[model samples]
Target: MATNGVHIIVSGRVQGVGFRWMTKMVAAKLHITGTVANQMDGSVEIYAVGASDQLAQFEAAVKASPTPSGRVSDYQATPLDPVPTFKNFDVIG
Candidate 1:
């Protein structure tokens, strides 16, 4: 897909779960640079930048396993204006 800055919003049963932490771990393993956060609206928000192949890996990582108590109803991703300066992924609030 050759994505630039990839933004994703995963909905359903995500808040209060370990989604963000798990995302950080996978992102680190894949060398994805971005941020993952728990949205107030009970979803998980992810903003990551990397190669398209890596992004595919990232997407799979996100969907493969959520928290033990988490179940995703739907998730959407969009290509963002490239931000190539990012370095290392993190969990934000």
Candidate 2:
């Protein structure tokens, strides 16, 4: 299976709610490699690289709001032409 990358932006009640941490946990479970961070705009940004099916599952998990306190109103995922390489998923920023 070919690997793929996605840049995801999650909006609404995501900051200060363990969203990034939860994202990291989810990524690990799905064997995804990348980073999740809290954006200045009260949104969460995630860059994930994994198998295509795993990427789809990751997207759904993200949209489902990994944290109980987090509410994902909008989830925008864009495919990356050149997939990023990361040793492991991390909670950044």
Instruction: Write candidate 2's Cα lDDT for 33-84 as tens digits.
Output: 9999888888888999999899899999899999999899998989988887
Candidate 2: C-alpha lDDT: 0.91
Worst 10 residues of 1 by lDDT: 63-72
State the local distance difference test value for candidate 1. Answer: 0.80
- Please report how far candidate 1 places residue 67 from its true position, in Å: 3.2
What local distance difference test score does each model get? 0.80, 0.91
The candidate maximizing TM-score is 2
Error of 1 at 22 (Å): 0.4
Model 1: per-residue Cα lDDT over 32-81, one tens digit each: 89898888888888999987788789888787654677778888988887
Total clashes for model 2: 0
